[model samples]
Target: MLNLKNYLCCLLLGVVFASPIFAQVPVQKNTFSGGITVTNNGISLLPTFTLGKPAAIFDFAVKSKRWSFEPQLRFSLEGKPWSFVFWGRYKVIDD
Candidate 1:
């Protein structure tokens, strides 16, 4: 259902407020930010995902860190909804 999809997106957005991994474990702090976005992937045709929209995205990354996590937030379209992605990275090579 459309409502269900929206709810899932909302949940992702809300829960993604945690600190990122690269922030703590990094050779250098990378504060990378980009412009606003809308309708990245065209899954909009699906009747069940009518409300499928996207917003802007931000990515912050660090390298050579251990036990770190990077949290990502992406939108479906303009004012549509947001999804949360949590990633943890460990440095295998110290170099």
Candidate 2:
């Protein structure tokens, strides 16, 4: 159930990472991120932890290259609505 933004971003990342031109280039080597989640019922769940029942959770991710991008995929455990978003970084940052 992947979304368009995820596919596109992953594709672009693959192209950037797989090309022989940047093969030897050593950019950022790693990433680490996590956030706390708050439920509408007034409960909070920290990352690496889980709530006993269905709850709203928010997540974030970052890509570290100069022209990097991040796409998010989200799903609901209740009504099961899903979505994807593309955000952060663009080629227009030519500075």
lDDT of 1 by residue, 1-95 (tens): 99999999989876785456335653564443334334445333245544443345554444333445566556554544455556778777665
Instruction: Find the candidate with the highest lDDT and give its number.
Output: 2
* TM-score (all chains, Cα) for each model: 0.37, 0.34
lDDT (Cα, tens digit) per residue for candidate 2, span 31-81:
546553545532332433333455545556554545555554444567453
Q: After superposition, how far is residue 48 of candidate 2 from its true place, in Å?
A: 31
Q: Any runs in candidate 1 off by more than 4 Å, and if so which? A: 1-39, 42-55, 62-64
Candidate 2 has what TM-score?
Answer: 0.34
Relative to the true structure, how large is the alpha-carbon lDDT of every model? Answer: 0.54, 0.54
User: Which whole-number lDDT from 0 to 100 does residue 25 have in model 1?
Assistant: 56
Give the per-residue Cα lDDT of candidate 2 at 76.
50
